[model samples]
Target: MGGHFQGARERPNGPRQRDGECSRGAGRNRQIHRGLCSPSQFSTPRVECTPTRETPIARRCPDAPMRVAGQPQARSTVKSTVFVVVLVFSLIATGADAQRGPDTLGKIKAAKSINVAFSGDSLPFSYVGEGNKPAGYSIDLCQRVIAGIGQAVGEANLKVNWIVGTAAERVQMVATGKADMECANTTMTQTRLKDVDFSNLIFVDGGGFLVTVDAPINRFTDLNGKKIAVIKGTTTEVRLNAAMKARLVNAQVTTINDGSEGIALLTTGAVDAFAGDKIKLIGLAAQAKDPNKFAMLMEDLSYEPYAFALPRGDAAMRLEVNRALTKVYVSGDIEGIFAQWLGKLGRPSGLLAAMYLLNAIPE
Candidate 1:
């Protein structure tokens, strides 16, 4: 063994050559051999091949990272690669499952009756008409929409299911699908869109102040410290507070049930002014025993765009309703519906006509 190592050391670049054939003075490169045998090894030193043991040297290519033979990292890399492949396939399968089928449209088609939520007190838009049934301009517009749906579904005469609700109540009814669409005086505000979608603009109104003709108030500021009546759960209640704070009109607010209640409060001197939509203020005032006894403030507080509210994410139903409304706007039927319900308030303004024209969807 000693002699063999001595010969190997003489040719340190490689194992010793055959007898008398010395690697020394030979201008040839040498190759690394893992077959070198040894009972024990030395760093960067040659070892003799022997029958007792074998020596395996872990080698790395020049400029390449060092790796050990029989190491566990290779097995780990294979496992990780397989895991990534499986995960990609699983994600694609889940995505395929997510393609939804029919929803609200199918339910409505199966029921064969379009459920409608109308307001009991929002006159001219939707209100309790003859025999306490739902009727108004908005209701008539919704009827036209239902007629279209009836034609599409081949029902020809689809039945109507009325669900009378207030402003806040109607919003919940539509969002939960308890009502197909709310044909009420619901304003199309950004905040409301979180829960439901609105059709084209139906009625454009703004906050107006109502006061008895004999009241000391002549302007908004005159109502300071005066009791103001507003309908509870309506946009007017919120707008009334906001307007009072912004203008420094420190008036006391009283929330009532409906316009009729506000009118009653005005007659009893319980409320100094009734604040609500201009159209509604006039509607309430026109119903008084003497129409000349009350007056409405000329200035508007905020622009309120009323539209029909429907269930959120029901694109099919919303599209059908919009198509029906657009057809009405293009035809001459809208004018008659407005005259029948809102003629007492006078003709539609130019801005109102523009609403119909702009929202009249083509095709």
Candidate 2:
């Protein structure tokens, strides 16, 4: 029949006929006289309609839609999967960019100069010397690091701008990018590492009390009910307070601005004792009006490990700084540098010598 039928098949060649043209007959006698007939319309069919490679589904059934229906959920799922993949890649790229951070070496190369923050009062480590220029043990080490930086950037001579400030101020300068490096008697501590990085250990010292010769204090226990002065915002100050509290010493603690001020306070009898790094106190005592009148207690309250402070998270700049420091330690040039500024101290102690030996990294 020419009319549509469900699950129907068509003949290969059939006589043309009008719609619904079929000969009526009894039981098995009915037949299509002159038109296409569906195999499903008869008990014994002549042909079947199965799609194959030679005949696609659309070709076999011309009324079928190109795309199958009722799959909107699947389409949405594919889009969501694609979006997640793209987002993951984007986050990875952002994290990589964040970790690469600022280029400190490139900035130094472009400026052809480096700003070094130093202490103008911490004698022997960093301080104002003859002609009002920065000079000391830490300054000598920083010069070598600067030279190494110059070679790394292909500059023969890089101008160094020495900025004078206190120890705490120097650390802030390096952290804020106002200074390239901080050359001072800055101690490397767990607290300071959060804001700034440090070079390899350059010097080691201990906190002690520097008092007038006539003072009644002979040991930490004698400092009860006495006044003591210490440089403000220094590791020595923090350690001094801790030590006093631990020892139950009821001494009055005062804060001074620098080593010079601490010395003045001790000399003027404003404080019974002055607490500072042992080596620094020696330097201050040696420069006092009456050197013979001052005596440093033969006791160390806290350990101090000194290093040069650099900007935090700058691995390349730190590598160069350490490389230069390692070279100085390896070549035996550190001896001369030490004697130039601290020769009056006799010789480097066993502890200090061990520090130099341990930090001498190989090329």
Model 2 score (lDDT): 0.83
lDDT by residue for model 1 over 1-363, one digit each (tens)?
122111111113344444333223453324233333222444555544333333233432234443333434656666666877787799878776554422656677788888888888777777898997888788899889889888777777778899987788889898888988888788888878998888878778888899999988888888998999988888888888898899999989998878889999998899999998888788778768988999887777788898999877666777888889889988878989999988877888887888878887777
What is the Cα-based lDDT of residue 266 in candidate 2?
Answer: 86
Q: Give the winner by lDDT.
A: 2
Candidate 2, after superposition: displacement of residue 291 in Å?
Answer: 1.5
RMSD to the true structure for each prediction, in A, is 11.7, 12.1
lDDT of each: 0.77, 0.83
Worst 10 residues of 1 by lDDT: 1-10
lDDT of 1 at 347: 85
**Error in Å for residue 316 of model 1:** 1.6
